[model samples]
Target: MQCRLVVNGFLSSSKFSEIYAWLKAAFEKRGHDMTVCTNIELAFEKTAVTEPILFWDKDVTLAKGLEAMGLRLFNSSRAIEYCDNKALTYIALKDKVPMPTTIPAPMTYRNIGYTHTEFVKKAGDLLGYPFVIKECFGSFGQQVYLAKEPSQAMSIVKNTREPLVFQKFIAESQGKDIRINVVGGKAQAAMLRRNEKDFRANITIGGKMEKYTPSAEEINIAEYVCDILGLDFGGVDLLIGSSGPLVCEVNSNAHFKNIYDCTNINIADKIAEHIEKCMDI
Candidate 1:
């Protein structure tokens, strides 16, 4: 079998390179020929091929084009779009999965910014203090914030130009969260991320990781979330709320390097196998 691996050209980094190398090797080991292509490479192409695409980029336009060209993408363009924005992810899974009380921030034009503070106050009032504020489109937990007071929360909202969401912060889950990797409707590997010094438990933000065995319920929710979101493979971040597990976020193209370090699980291999099964290779 032969496949095209599509990624963003400008977003190249050491982490991305490493993951690409692993995935390429994994696919090759399974008797598959994987060719790495960037969005730029297909920018002017007016032809279509019969090979499947493993899209690793957030370039929705390019992904859609490829799909329309009769190519099957691993996660699909729709799934990637839904997971790219936190608010969209919340909306897509709110009814299908357990999640925090998430409210999309009121729309504000980038040029005008927040013209008033009333909406921010309203969000603060509803979510209460220590609420979670997250940029709709972000990664590595950098755009997530824990607003301790209404004033600070309002300030954070007023200063931002990007779309955001306000969520009920689960106090019990502070500094910790579980990341479950789901592939082909199955929970594959999971790890617990903890940051004693920060409320966010993202490994990129100095969080520690440990191999974790998820509960049956966690596994169910993780896989179900993927099924509903049309994700071929992803990482579901869940918070242990007082009542049960509440979804924190979902990653369409989830980074697996940290989880590999913790669990010694090469998710790339699982991904390759899943793709083979999916494509009937």
Candidate 2:
């Protein structure tokens, strides 16, 4: 199969570039032709939709445009959009999956910032203090925060000039979580991430990783989330709840280098195989 890998143009970090290179190599190993291109390249060029596009970036506009031109995308544009925004992800999976109680911050314009943060107090009343505040769009646990008091919560809300969400903080899962890599409706690999100094267990932020064998329930929840989100593949973060695993986040284009180091499982190979099976069908 002939394919193209679409990545973000603005992001030039080696972390992202390495993933693209590994994916390209995986596809080539399978005797499939794959080319890498940035969103900027495709945006300016009048390119024809000749082959399938493995969208590895979060540029939803370009993904949608390519879809409109009749090119098949591995994970559809709609799926990427839903996963790109934290509030949207919760809204999409609220009733279908088990997750922390989440409350979306009211919409506010960037020019006209929040005049009054009364909603933060209300959210505090519902979710209590020391809750989670996450920007709608972020990665690697950078935008996630913990507000220990109402004042801090209100301050964080007023300062952040973008869409965000309030979530109940699972103290039991603080500084630890599970990252499950799902492909083609299956949980292919998993890792336990723990941060000794921070609450966020993302490997990018000084978190430690070790191979993890997910429980049956955890795997089921992860796989079901991908199915509901219409994702061809994704990385599902699960917090260890008192009762069972709670869905923390679903990443449509999740970076897998850390998971590969932990589990010695190359998710790129799984993705390539899945795409080949899909194109065959």
Candidate 3:
């Protein structure tokens, strides 16, 4: 299997490389020819129309444009676009899973004749304090905020200059969350992310983790999310709210390194195997 991987802005665009070195090795271990490209034009020449394309970027060009060019993509462009946008992913899965009470506010969060207290001015009810505000395009919990008050929320809104959504702040979580990694519609691994001091519990935000097991019900919910998106792989983030596990977001390209380090799960190999199967099909 000869392959070319397209990455727009990589995990490390500088002196640090070896971001996808493991997968590259996996492909070569199976005797597949490989190439990595940042420029689509540079990659297009050697690529066969039907050959498998593994895209790590969100440019939509490699996934949509290449698929239109008759390339066999591991994950479709539709899946990437749907998952890339936090608002869309939430809307798509809100009804499918037990989800947080979410309200899509204006990107600017303007008064618009609404009182500062109303936040919506009569359009909608004010939601949880310390609201969870996520930017439209982000990853690794980089664009998340824990706004303890409306003033803080407004401040964040002013700074980001991007559309945002607010979800009920889950006190029970105590700045902790769960991430379930699914491959081929199966829950491969689960972990609990917690930070007693920080409001955001992303590992990148100094959140700590431990090897945690998921209940059968949790696994079932993760599977349901994967089925809803028709995605080959996913990392579903669930907030253990007062009710139960309420899904907050789903990521198309969940990094396996941390989960891989914490649990010693060979998730990369599983993803590699899954991609190989897609190529064969």
Candidate 4:
């Protein structure tokens, strides 16, 4: 079977490129023809799609267009949109899944910015000190921040001109979290990320990772989040809460290289196998 891989054109970092290469090679090893193209390359093309598209980028508009053209995407466009926005992910899984107490920042135009931050005070009052503030659309823990006071929270709101969320900080899970890579509704690999110097436990930001075995509840939550978001595969980050595991974040196109290094499981290969099962090829 022939397939096309769509990646972000602007992301030229070797970290991003490495994942793209591994995915391409994995598909080829499974006896499939894989062609890679940037989202920009197909952005204005008016041609109909002939084969499945392995969308590895967060370009939701392009993914949606391809889906409208009768082409199947591994993780559907809707799924990508839900996972792309931190607020939307919390909203979608609000009552169904265990997660941190998250409140969407009131809508504000980028031009106007936050005129008054009274809402930030309210959020701080509700969530308390040292809560989390995350930009709606971000990855690798870059846009996530911890506010130790109302002043800091308001500062974050004023400085950030994009959509965002206010979340209750899981004190127990500070500087640590679990990443479960789920494919085709199953948990394939799990890793524990630890960062002693930073609150965020992302590998890109100095977090160390080790292979982990997830609890049944953790695996179930991870799989259920994917199912709810209509994702064929995803990486679910879980905070080890005092009560149980709380959903930290979900990635529609999660990078698997760190998990691969920790677990020695090539998630790209599992993704290829899952795609074959999905397409019956």
Which is the winner by lDDT between candidate 1 and candidate 3? 1
TM-score of each: 0.97, 0.98, 0.87, 0.98
List model 1 lDDT by residue over 226-261, tens digit each: 998999999999999999999999999998899899
Error of 4 at 175 (Å): 0.2
In order of listing, the candidates' clash counts read 0, 0, 1, 0
lDDT of 4 by residue, 107-163 (tens): 999899998899999999999999999999988999999999888888889887889
Q: Which regions of candidate 3 deviate over 4 angstroms?
A: 10-16, 39-50, 107-125
Q: Write candidate 2's Cα lDDT for 1-281 as tens digits.
A: 88999999999999999999999999999988998888999997626547999999888999998988888898899999999999999999998999999999999999988878998999999998799999999899999999999889988988889899999999999999999999999999999999999999998899999889999999999999999999999999999989889999999999988988888999999999999898883
The TM-score between candidate 4 and the true structure equals 0.98
Q: Which candidate would rank higher by TM-score, 1 or 3?
A: 1
Model 4 worst lDDT run, 10 consecutive residues: 41-50
Superposed by TM-score, candidate 2 places the C-alpha of residue 104 at a distance from the truth, in angstroms, of 0.7
C-alpha RMSD of each candidate structure in angstroms: 1.1, 1.0, 3.6, 0.9
Off by over 4 Å in 4: 46-48
Q: Give the TM-score of candidate 3.
A: 0.87
Misplaced by over 4 Å in model 2 are none
Shift in Å, residue 39, candidate 2: 0.7
Candidate 1 local Cα displacement, residue 124, angstroms? 0.9
The lDDT for every candidate, in the order shown, is 0.91, 0.92, 0.73, 0.92
The clash number for model 4 is: 0
